[model samples]
Target: MAEQTQVHREQAGINAAAVRSAETAESTQQRLPRCRKLLFQFEVDMYAKIKTERLSFIRHNQTRLRADDYIYLHDAVADDRNANRLGNMVILPSSFTSCPRYMHERTQDAMTYVRHYCRPDLFITFTCNSKWDEISNELLPGQQSYDRHDVVARVFHLKLKQLMDYITTGAIFGAVRCHIYTIEWQKRGLPNAHILTWLWFHVPSTGSMWPAKQWFTLHERRFPIHARHPTVQHLSVHLENGQRVYFTEANLQQQLQEPRDTTLTAFFKLCTLDDFARTLLYCQLPAYYTFDASTKCWKRRVQGSSVPDHPGIYQTDALARVYTVHPNNRECFFLRIILHHVVGPVSFHHLRTVEGHVCATFHETCRRLGLLKDDAQWREALEEAATVRSPA
Candidate 1:
């Protein structure tokens, strides 16, 4: 009996320690300020130049420019030689000066083949974040001498491809229809890829399909759903006038006032596993909220229509089964939030229409600036990268 009592005490101590650690982490995260949003200057001129140059190249080939061809074809980025912060000319590579028409033509062919075979839905972009300390530490490893651009480009390429492989084949989301990736160098000479991937599937569209019924196969085992049933997953819990309150699916809509197009409802409906792990994610930071007596939850300022049932579908995510409904195509609330958080404001223009033309324009800019390597070098790199790849 003494031994059992000691084991119980140890377990209780571990649980208490874990709770304290989680609270500390949450408090720290809440204290951290969100990075300010910024826009890249290329948004103004790079895309226009690509469209003009791409048209001339295509017209001469006697081939029609299908909406999808933009994914593979393009021109070099145009930079204002006089607009530098330090007033010094940006020294770019010699090859970066001209757009390679032949290379883009070949890429167009590859994209055509992919479009015919794969019916992709979600279009995604993957760019390397220079601010990531972990990558900098690994690539720069103490006392290593290397061309900053070359090393950074190589590492980002390999890492991005690794992530792409995982996403396409992973159970979370199946095979992508096709993916077009091109590397570009920023004014500061940092290399990043403008990648466009069309996944094979996506979340159900909004409107008539709005509020998609939670998909699940009923089993012999029982599952928790409501708050009073103490064993289900919850977003929050607190004491309300001395009565213990839990935020479960039953009260989520009433207590949280979640917008119609938000993912909260769908997520909670599908959150069936009582023992499933939970994570807390704050919406916006540098902003604080106080619990409302009427709503019984934290009140914070948010963008998007609060009217519920805002018309028009703007975005979709298959893995999460979430949709953002907005009347305007470019004003997708959820996607904007994602771009702000994941890609940073510098690359905000990369987010665009589902057809992915603007992204291709960025690739064209890379080619014009000679940021993209010539066919021979690119082919050699692909051969080397493929040598160790496991066959499908």
Candidate 2:
């Protein structure tokens, strides 16, 4: 009996030791860092390549213009420049402008008059979808489901940081003052963004510079229609007080109002996870122009066009063009943002139009100025211009 009791005790001790070892192993597995797992699951090298491609697109297009031009247009104005130009440049408002007191009063009166004659029905609906489920099957098999929105938001964050870094590094240097607001929106099934921006600059006084006629004259131009309007016109005027004020109008109503708290607003402020996702999209997925080997030139790829019911990317008739990357496939990430449709006070006479006329003119001008050699590509670029579409 003594021997039997001793044997039983030994067996219990072994069992306990085995249980403790198993528990320790389980805990270690649970507590392991996820970095290695994620690295193994997703092709980190491929992701890095994607990031490189995105950055390359920005560098390619942005570098085509003089750095001074970008800095002058996109940065803050120096005080000296402001003083010399007599403050003929002012910041423009964004898309979220509301009615002023006078306009509000007029609107109220008009509503009261119309309300008595007609009744309108109003309705609102809310919809939601899981980002993971929407994109899971699109990912490689055995790959973990990551949120597409989140990935885009992360990309934007990185891009913003890079832009800031570039500015600080003196890669972009100028005297103009500017502010940018990135807004994101995902309501119902639609998800997109708006970048509310303000810029203040000064033009050197040549005595012939007239604020009212030469400066304040806003021209009808085409701009990107990210949200509502397809085109916009922007202008600025010098006031008697030596301050320049800018404005934008569409259909007799101002579209550039004060910035509002849209999804993009929240994202820039880091107020919500949704914003982070948007930031990612902005940084990672900015549209760019890519060289089409088959076409033997650059072309624009629409984002997310592979999705059902998506309208393919359209070419414009305007001089300046904004290109975007097609969101559906990774191969066509470098898309162009044709600036032709953009509405602003500045004349796009220098920009090449798709109709090939402006480009031909530019090439001739460059030749006259001894700036460019007569190359075959110039003719090719001109031949491609006839395809741009003007806004109706």
Candidate 3:
């Protein structure tokens, strides 16, 4: 290309020195005509000049240009996390792409895929095999597979493309709804593709060992979740005050409010008139009844919801789970304990009741039940430390 360009430059009666070769551009050293290397520099210079001209125009026409804050990391970063106070933070903008920030951005973006398609069903790896006939056949007599990096790269690229086609076209994993893949170079300079395929929720006729429906069935049989209903959904516990509200932000345009009725409140209302409900524990609610989210209530299910053979029995395949509470939250931890032993609590205060006495606090209620261990050892250790050791 340089020889052809030089031919045209000569025809146009342009000076040989005009489009400078490496010899003219740098007096230090020039082994060969560096037009190929100089071509890269020419592009870089042209881009910078264009940017400089635009900035000059924008500055002159400040009134015409729409104003906004501009933060550019052209040469380097301008911000650091209190580097002077702690220590030096030498990381620059160029390094940021491979830094933790870049990794974090990619990981968060990966979650959006998981959320949309549910979790991935298959994890696949396509590593470049050095022994492939395509790469091995093209090698010279004495040369190894790694001798020609170009050949290895080209062959791997083509193979990866074909593999991707098979997955995306629903040929490999039957009816693959979607797939996510990433390519990485190993230490041997060979590329490999990591793939995650979200399979369609149908069992195919052939060439499929792990379709979504079959996978779920196998797992559910091995690890049943209490009892399986026809379907399960988010249920509101209205009697637990403000339990349904998620405080995601400190301020809102309008105050958030939940509906007045929920499963817990509905149960209390039901127990007032039904002796059966009063006898049932909170955890057993779903096994006996189905939640009506639209009405914010629980209704008796038709017979055979669980026990299909019996027509007179009231049983269901579903069971409502009283979720375990983290011990860090004292009140909730205490409440969960009482819910396990108590049946059909009408109110939060009722859960705190021990035997016949209405306790003032949930903590005191658990203590009365002998659920909380005494902290005499810890208390004595701290008291001794206070007298013996300095505050620091």
Best by TM-score: 3
RMSD each, Å: 31.3, 29.4, 20.0
**Stretch of 10 with least lDDT, candidate 1:** 224-233
**Candidate 3 whole-model C-alpha lDDT, 0 to 1:** 0.52
In model 2, the runs with Cα more than 4 Å from the true position are 1-128, 131-134, 141-226, 230-392
The residue-level lDDT of candidate 3 at 268 comes to 69
Per-residue lDDT of model 2, residues 255-335, tens digit only: 112222222122223323222223232222122222233433333444323423434533321111222223342222211
TM agreement with the true structure for every prediction: 0.24, 0.18, 0.34
Q: Could you say which candidate leads in lDDT?
A: 3
Evaluate residue 146 in candidate 1 and report its C-alpha lDDT on the 0 to 100 scale: 28
Question: What lDDT does the true structure give each of the candidates?
Answer: 0.33, 0.29, 0.52
Q: Give lDDT: candidate 2, residue 105.
A: 31
Pitting candidate 1 against candidate 2, the one with the higher lDDT is 1
Worst 10 contiguous positions by lDDT, candidate 3 = 216-225
Runs of candidate 3 exceeding 4 Å displacement: 1-240, 245-259, 305-313, 373-392
Question: Candidate 1 residues 1-392, lDDT tens each?
Answer: 36445545555565455334323134565221121111122222433444444443334322211111111111100232211121112222222323454343334333332323433344455566665443455332232212233235545555554555555544235545455555555676565555445655653333442123322221112111110100111122111111121232233233224322112322222222211111222222112222244544333324322323423211111111112223243223333233222211122243332234554333343333343456643453354334323121
Q: Give the TM-score of candidate 3.
A: 0.34
